[model samples]
Target: MTTTAPPEHPPAGSAPGSAAGRLWRAGRAPAAVIGLLVAVSVLLSLGSEQFPSGHLEPGSPEPDGARALVRLLDEDSDLTVARTSEAAVRAVERSGEDTVLVVLLDHRLLPEELDTLAGLGSDTVLVRPSLRSLAAFAPGADMTGRVDDERTLEPGCALPAAASAGDAGVTGELYTAGNGVEALGCYPAADGSGLLQVAAPDGSTTTVLGTGDPLTNRELDSAGNAALALNLLSAEDVVWLRPDVPEEVGSATLWELVPAGVRWSLAPLALTLLLFALWRGRRMGALVPESLPALVRASETTEGRAGLYQSRKARDRAASALRNGFLERSVPKLGLRTDSGPDSVVAAAAARSGEDPQDLWRLLYPSQPDPYTADDEAMLRLADELDRLSGRLR
Candidate 1:
């Protein structure tokens, strides 16, 4: 195959409008398109403001975040946002009777931490508690129902906070008090209610608000949501615990995990690799290309590959190379499509060479174990046949 020769080396120039300048001219349009896209992206990004978003988070200004309620509570209460169960417990302990511990995402805490928090006996609010959290915070208070719709439910119970809040967007998980459990259920929906107030034996109250929707930034202003959140959380000190990604349970050193022998070898291995890189790498600038002869010599490449095949005694591979070259050149000349079926190729090849179709098929698309692969002479014979056939077609 022949190819138009490219320059053996890039012309040496440092000027702004030399060989490099032409390259720049060729590429500037695409670069300008990319630049415009980047500019538009930057402008769009600048025009839009993204608020930190998280579910019922105090600092997040997203629809699900409690930032609006948090700000309201911050006005009246000394609010502390804690990301860990340990920190939440500590925050509550530091405060007096005027403090209320409000725990969100209690599912992130361990069973022991939940029990310890429950044991604090502080006026607490559990938001969307898991069954385990429910059992720890308010025993015998089971999640009995769920409010699928986003309707505003009336405060049906006599809880001061619920009543003051009036009708609220408490459309979320619902719960029920056990038969003997002395608890007050509020905002009745379906079989259960959205809020369960259970007074601890130690004079502390555990208020389980079934849904977090009412406290989130998006719904805080709708129908007494702000009032209810403020009423429950307004205290001298309020500890708002919103758990983050759970901390690693246990610690293990990655280096220590490796075998002692392997670990000891790593230092020397790294040093040797660095030294080897420095020794073998290019010490200065880029490689200079060798100048090409004015005349092209394509046959040199073909002869070099032929010599390699002969040295390795790769008869099967040599036969394959011969057949592939003939097919590539003759198939197109024979008006056969590159993707034509094997039968069409075989028939066309047979017609062009004036040979029997079966013999042509055996030569071009050999059957089981390939008869030509037996020896060098057979491979030579196959190559001769393909070359003769291709010559005839030409």
Candidate 2:
């Protein structure tokens, strides 16, 4: 079919406001929008200081830090606060009963460290003990669950520490004191206990407090928190053990690092992405009729037919058509009848072309032993010989 030629493209730099320039201009809006969004985020982060920093760190001045409590122990009280676990252990070792080893950040401590701290001759206070640390240090005390409320509660049990503190912020993990150990359960939870004081065989006390919130700088002044912290930390020397993240725990598996909620949340996001891909990747527009060349030459059609015949291996059909076409065209030129037999046609062709009659007969028709089988090679040979004889007739 007839087709119009496409319009020629303009030379490079011909038009300053071409499609390329327009495309470049189009990207600026999105880039500026992204930059603005980033700037806004940075400004918001700089403006707000809602969350506390350096959780439970003695040296930190942030609200969440235990700097106030450390200062209280260092200045107001006579107890000298030893910072690291190594220093605390050494101080406890040197002073013996004179030193009080107060364990903070118990979750970071190793089992061996917990054992060492638990077996100390001096009184030890464990703040925010993980289940593993609690089980290792205080055998009978088991964490039940977490407390929803962070409000102060009355000291229900008769432990001297609790009784003296009166109402205290013991709102964290609730625990239960088993019958095997000589332990006092304090700050009674609905189901179990919030605090446990176990008398170790080494003549030293192991106090398990549920949370470290009450001991932090922010909550230290709230509801008998100062009184409770002071009473618990009252000693000649204080060894504050801030346990570092253990090597074994630090090498936790990928699954352990991802929280359950975050893992669950990924499922929906993944499904959404999958659905988006399917939607965007699908075939979009409807089918349109394509224009073809207006005219196909006779020679091209003949070559195309031959190609189709060769591809389909239609040797018999091709041979028959070739022979019929040759005979129909050459019969008039050779002065032979249209109804002439194969022998007559071969004799006429041989006489005109000066070829042997036997060869012409063989080319015209298959012999008794080997009838026309329509093999591709045999068909081609016959067609070529026929063309040579037909040339003689012309």
| Deviation in Å, model 2, residue 81 alpha carbon | 5.1
RMSD score of candidate 1 (Å): 16.6
lDDT of 2 by residue, 213-297 (tens): 8888889999988888888888877877775554664678889876555555555555555765675578888988988869789
CA-lDDT, candidates in order: 0.83, 0.75
| Residue lDDT tens for model 1, 1-394 | 9999986774566566688788888768656655665555445545655565689878888788888788878888888989888998889889888889998888788899899998988999999899999899899999988888988999997888889889998888888989888899889987798888987788888888888888888888899988888888878999998888765755657876655544444554455557556755746887789887686578988898889998998877888887787778878987989888889998887787788999888988888788997888888788787777777877
TM-score of decoy 2: 0.48
TM-scores for all candidates: the values are: 0.54, 0.48
| lDDT at residue 344 of model 2 (Cα atoms) | 81
**Candidate 1: stretches off by over 4 Å:** 1-51, 247-394
**Angstrom error at residue 380, model 1:** 25
